[model samples]
Target: MDFHYHSLPDLFEQLGLPAEMPAVEHFIERHHPLPAAMLLADASFWSPSQASFLREEVLGDADWAEVVDDLNSRLHH
Candidate 1:
């Protein structure tokens, strides 16, 4: 699959996150992937459910892997 956007905010929106630039930026800045990976699906934030969906439905399977990997790369970087 060909994923379009790569920025955290865009990926967030694609993944059904809030997608607000400022908020997304702040979130990425505050939560690094090292921790976000563990906290994403369980965090007390909007990502808990959303992240679970992405991890289980998207990345967990072969479908949407491109976007999921892209988002992961962007989030980690």
Candidate 2:
């Protein structure tokens, strides 16, 4: 089996968002500093489908989990 290493841009594409680095950076900048008590998947900016994808990937410890965790950290700071 081929293992594909995913990146933040890939995650954005998978979520049907802009995948360019600038767009990704802009997105993070727009949504920076998520509330400490808020879960990444529970943030108001995400669509239901996007939120579900994040929750499932993290809860299942799937391939997307690492990147999702990375996003979570970025959002928190």
> Which candidate number has the best TM-score?
2
The local distance difference test score of each candidate is 0.59, 0.94
What digit string (tens of lDDT, one per residue) describes model 1 on residues 1-77? 54443555655776676788887767767755645455334444544567666667454554455556655555566
RMSD of each: 4.2, 1.5
36-75: candidate 2 lDDT, tens digit per residue: 9999999999999999999998998888988999999999
Native-vs-model 2 lDDT? 0.94
Regions more than 4 Å wrong, model 2:
1-3
Candidate 2 Cα deviation (angstroms), residue 54: 0.3
TM-score of every candidate: 0.46, 0.94
10 residues in a row with least lDDT, candidate 1: 38-47
